[model samples]
Target: MKHILNTLIIGSLIAATASSCTAKFEDINSEPYRPGDLSADDYALGSAMNNLAGCVVSSDVNTAQFTDCLMGGPLGGYFADSNANWKATISFFNATDDWTRVFLKSDKVLPVLFSNLSVVEVVSQNTSNPVPLAIAQIIKVAAMHRVADTYGPIPYSKIGADGSITTPYDSEEMVYNKFFEELNSAIAVLNEHPNDRLTATADYIYQGDIQKWIRFANSLKLRLAMRIVNAAPDKAREMAEAAVDPQFGGVIEQNADNAAWTYFSGSVNNPLFVAKEYNHEGSKTGGDTHVAADIIAYMNGYDDPRREKYFVKSEWTGIDYVGMRRSAKVPELKTIGRKYSGINLSPNSPLYWMNAAEVSFLRAEAEAVYGFNMGGEAKTFYENGIRLSFEQWQADGVDEYLAKETKKSISYVDPNEGINSYDKELTNITVKWDESATPEQKQERIIIQKWIANWLLGNEAWADYRRTGYPHLLPATEEGNKSGGVVDSNRGARRMPYPVAEYNDNAENIEYAVNTYLGGRDDMSRDLWWAKKK
Candidate 1:
């Protein structure tokens, strides 16, 4: 993508950090260790922004494959593994090194590219200017939230401070509190300079549009606030209200206002596209990217119009759309791969960081859950989410689709399975909203729709599933988790354990974090503070 140049800037910074200092020298860290004037420029800020956006939408890198794609995509029931190696982890819930990849890229690269000291220096240099600093803070919050959400706790406020090389982990509460504070600071600054911007030349997402940045900040706040609904309802309500509060800035309401990162064709293409189209090693076939059976069953049952754009027909079975079972083995997956639908792997696909459909669904959940004001009734917002999702994909027949109230998720039947392949009927969840449904039923309906609307965004779906336990997903295969009887196969994975490297150098900190926030164990079965079901 054209944004490849932006990533190269951050890549060079990572290389510089790796080769700058020798392992045996502590006294040789003075001149060459310092960033030049170019590192503190607005272009650097642009590079940092690009880097954060890229990670948030990561699907290609090893770190992202484990954290975002493997943990998220499969757990959320969006995709299934093609290789037996990956399938073992996905189906049996085994702990692997793949889960550690996200932190490696994030810790070793991003924070350094936009160092905290450099950002503070830039802010001090531009005392009369708040746009640059505000933008930097928003990017920081965007990047850090993914890390904090994946693991229970992280080094947030003091990551790059002097003498904080091996920073201690803050509790999840502290990290979220800091996120709110930073977002508040950014929103206040953005409000002060409503339309002003320092630079947009390097911005690949919104082109230096400060107004869009403000909207994105508020939208993010809404997301973070909703994440804590089970653990901190009062705080969630307070922040959710503020997100829609006209006194500050309003939440994202239009598809045109969505925050999506664009990509250039060729070598700088979207990683997800490359993985799907090219002969990635883990995939079953050279060009097979199978969708999950649950999604296909639900979409096909609802007569979804977006399926045409979301998936391609199977060349083997000659079926219009067929999704693979989540626990299928390599041989079955290989044959089924020939008949299963592949995702839209066009190099031109945009990576949506946040979208209006998500905002609408969030508002719907807020209204349905607590009767919070969201411009109108929860049903209206819910329907709008469906409409906007269709519009975003440029699909038609939404009005006709929305009008049907009898459509429900159909029972799944593996096309390649014979008499017994663990085919189960899904929850009879329907697309249309029922006015007289119970609160719990309404909540389930809302979340199920949200899950359907949010295609390719597996992390958010996984979080919501863990939080709400809606869109009732299939259980792990009979293989079960390889946790030595630690992880409950019925419960599924709650949060990823910290990287093994964190334990090597910062064992005390990791121990403290696990004991403080994770109930004295650094295991995958333990839920994060916010993920505990009410």
Candidate 2:
């Protein structure tokens, strides 16, 4: 949403490389290529993004395994690392950078094109369609947000122009502001022109529905606004205020308007789909990661029946649940296209990307932060968050999950709590959940729930855990990851390092940027500027 624009100003370099994509070149027999219109090959940009986004989130889920990795196999069942599972790959000890390159490419290229991704935006020019432009704008903003949020200050505004590898990076603060402006512009354009044709075509997501796009724009904006409250309170408050303002509107009221890309089963089972598909056929893969203990406790505490549907307890695991250390050796499974050891609800199955649940929770968070909120938004989001997560998983007894949250843990965040105020808030969440949970228990619930909602989404959960140190995720034991996969953060790992290739080639500039934004590129313990404690 609005956050996308701020990232755009940071200038993420366009990602042109792809597995199937060929180098763009001029044909000797063809007329000289013009620079104005994007080449026919440019379409691959979108194609690549669809793949990368799926992979990125899939990787994210694998890591968090709020489903299988941390909870499914490990804690729930006597842990077993099936061939298709991500337990070995994501065990707390084994974080890796294998997926960063592709993810960054998707994050960057889409944003570059979106900035000026000319989908014939001109009305009278006979080619202008605000719909595609808006979608592109939205995606671009979304893409850049992903890159910037994860990598810290990246090459944003100055990225496109072919300068030396030493291109300077922008500050996270500056990058965020640009995203706000970009979303604001997109919203304004969609409202004014409303391109149905191009939107129908370019809107690969929601099929050119302007209203849905609008909600996505607003919801995304709210998320961005909430993200920066710690770093830029005044700015964050303004963005949040604008989001709730009736005139400006807010996010989706229900799950129907979820902004997500659906994956096909066979060749296009999306990343997770394909990954599962191939793994099922005997792939060299890790076992399903188990759900985190805190999450299990919370759901179980609330008697959240969704547990069965959301996760499959390994029949093999005789323990309450078995969890593999990131360092644990994963069983090899030979497979072809895809495989499946764990279970993921279908795209049409509900809980996907950023949705009403998250937006509601975000609003609740914003209200809690502001201290003036009646918690109307918070309660709605909280209830919706819990209910939707269960329903999305096709959890068994629907009425119970819905009826479970009667005892709200509002008092957990007292200033007297042992830890930070944020910890207190999270405690209330668990406190609200547990039959006899303390304030600490309640806080864990909030962080755990947030983590649950963030499953298969992005690194936001990891980042949140680091920033707040809530939910108390267990560190990968010695049996988990023997060698650290990616850089580590205080709570876990901070922002991942820029790819080795980027650092190798663009050493000077990357060094400068990293030092400024994250203190040190190799120092995983360093918090991002925005994430650091005052």
How do the predictions measure up, each by TM-score?
0.87, 0.70
- The clash numbers for all candidates, in the given order, read 3, 73
In the range 430-468, model 1's lDDT, one tens digit per residue, is 777888888788888888888888888877888898889
Off by over 4 Å in 1: 1-42, 85-91, 104-128, 161-165, 278-289, 316-318, 332-334, 418-420
Query: What lDDT does candidate 2 reach at residue 507?
Result: 77
lDDT of each: 0.68, 0.48
Score residue 421 of candidate 1 by CA lDDT.
Answer: 41
Which candidate has the top score in lDDT?
A: 1
- Report residue 369 deviation for candidate 2 (angstroms): 3.4
Q: Give the lDDT of residue 294 in candidate 1.
A: 65
> Which pairs of residues have clashing backbones in candidate 1?
1-264, 1-268, 63-101
